[model samples]
Target: MLDDFMTRATLAGVGTALAAAPLGCFVVWRRMAYFGDATAHAAILGVALSLAFSMPIFVGAMIVALVMAAAVTLLTGRGYAMDTLLGVMAHSALAFGLVAVSFLSGVRIDLMAYLFGDILSVSHVDLAVIWGGALLVVALVAWRWSALLTATLNPDLARAAGIDPRREQLVLTLALAVVVAVAIKVVGVLLITAMLIIPAATARPFARTPEAMAAFAVVLAMVAAWIGLQTSYQFDTPTGPTIVCVVAVMFAVSSIASTLRRAG
Candidate 1:
């Protein structure tokens, strides 16, 4: 029999993987990997705010992540480069969050858990939040799929097709924020972006279509979660980083295979 806690952890891991896969594909498609980093970094600030306010971390992270994303969206193409802007926001938010957490001597929270992860410590309540948030994101993405794809291809083309590209962009931004907030418990702030990128990237070579890529990403992410959990359990390793390591190894293998195939 699976240990009860391990069972919850597995469910949580699989839920997070399902959420990350489709959204990660969009992140890869739109070249918004840096944006994921920035939003996730802002999650640290959310942690500070949640501690200060005595509210749920999910609410705090979601608010701050959305703000960070919106701030970037507004600043984009307005005489500022995306990479520079995201880098500034990402590091600044992280630094500020660290500083803020330090000032909160009145409360006690483990900073390392927020920075790295504490997936093994997840509870039933956390599972509810994780699954709820993940399903919401999946539904929202599915609803906006066509328009989002069109807008991602070309804002002008989307506009010409009577689709508001800005709206679609907002939809994606909102979804990304949700991912940032909910994923904090699973991979924490530092590794969230990796969970968002690596699986989709690993699946890229085997995919012949967009849908196929997403399916492959989901499968690969789930497999990584299972393997990562087992390896971490056996080795007494960090669950979150171990999962990312598994995904990274898969990516390496896929890259090598693709290279050899091309060479042949």
Candidate 2:
């Protein structure tokens, strides 16, 4: 019985790491850390709405994240300072979600669970949802990898090359929304950004190309997931935060190694 549970948990963790890996690469490439934070913050509202409407958490999060992404795109397209607008929207959504959750009287909802995730509690159905969503995201990203990279490297150049930057931005936004929704279940809203950023950052030193960077990022994220899970299980700590901490450690080690290599 214990072995069975461990197997299931490991499977779920692998699914999460796989999904996060590619998305994390894009998040780093485009410097979308704030955008990711915005989407993650909006996830709280999704959770609140899911409880209020008796819907699946994933469905609610995806819907809310897509809406938030669209709103950010539209607002920023109209000349708003990206940072200011994102900050307002992110904090406002989080505040509103807390207020919304407070209105529910009977059920005891631990906000921390949604904020930091409960990965060990993930069910088989959740794994299916994570893997299925991940596959879709991966397919879309793979198909548009070249165009996306072109845009990321030089938006003006991509535009000159007949690629529409706006359209590509929208595509990336949608991808990010899916990533945010799925990642919330793995690492929750507060820590989700760390998972996306840290692993990719750790992989940067070893990458000579965008594709290589992405591949390395995936490997780093998976390693962090495995190490983090083992640490969590052994130390009886929260799984999500432990994963973030592991990723952080990886980042620090990578940075130091890079510096040393440069000196040598």
Candidate 3:
């Protein structure tokens, strides 16, 4: 099964979707979409670091993503606006990463692969990393689901219940970093947040409970992955963007259905 490139690509997409679904719900609930962008954009710097230092891309990306997330979390309560801070950090990190990549002389690199992904080129080792990271994220989120939900719903109420909202935020930060790291090869830096946000958002209108929403998101993400791969393969389009486009279409259809239901 691993001998086939399509099989590997499909599994890679599924693994990334599994990790992103639950975390994406939290992103939507907390209105942290831009935050996801910031962390994902920082992944370019991670790629640069990995190449320069001769380390694994996942380790380098995870470390840089964690730093970016921690920086945002720490600086959020300071003077600068959250949006302003994220914009500056995200763009700056991406620019620096690109410049840094340029500085690596004699080493030919395809920036497109890191920027937009090369999922078809994924190997057996890559599959293992993706699945491992996915399972870890799922377990972490599951372990703290109740506390995380409470914190997301009402930080004050969470505090009243002795669940520290800040701690839950940290868990999310860690999970987001893991997703970005593992998903880099699947969706690349530019589209990681899309994989995270789109499925969850699409599932939103149809779900009555948080758990239901997450389950629907997983299903929708899986569907998008499979369909997107087929579409991209048939048309020879960029796979990562095609996947995102597919999910965006799903979101549009879901929104229309929701609006109609409300009207009816």
TM-score: model 3 vs. ground truth: 0.99
lDDT of 2 by residue, 1-264 (tens): 324666666666677777777878888888889999999899899989998998988889888988999999878857678999999999999999889999987767989889998788777777778788778878888988888888888999999999997888888778777777777777889988898788889999989988888888888888888888899999999999999999999999999999999999
Looking at candidate 3, what is the lDDT of residue 87? 99
Give candidate 2 regions above 4 Å deviation. 1-3, 77-79
Positional deviation of residue 139's Cα in model 3 after best superposition, in angstroms: 0.4
244 Cα displacement, candidate 2 (Å) = 0.5
Higher-ranked by TM-score: 1 or 3: 3
* Model 3 residue 259 lDDT score: 96
Put down candidate 1 lDDT per residue, 149-183, tens digits, no spaces. Answer: 88988889999999998888899889989888888
TM-score for all models, in order of appearance? 0.97, 0.95, 0.99
- Top model number, lDDT: 3
The weakest ten consecutive residues by lDDT in model 3 span 101-110
Off by over 4 Å in 1: 1-3
Instruction: Report, for every candidate in turn, its global Cα lDDT versus the true structure.
Output: 0.92, 0.85, 0.95
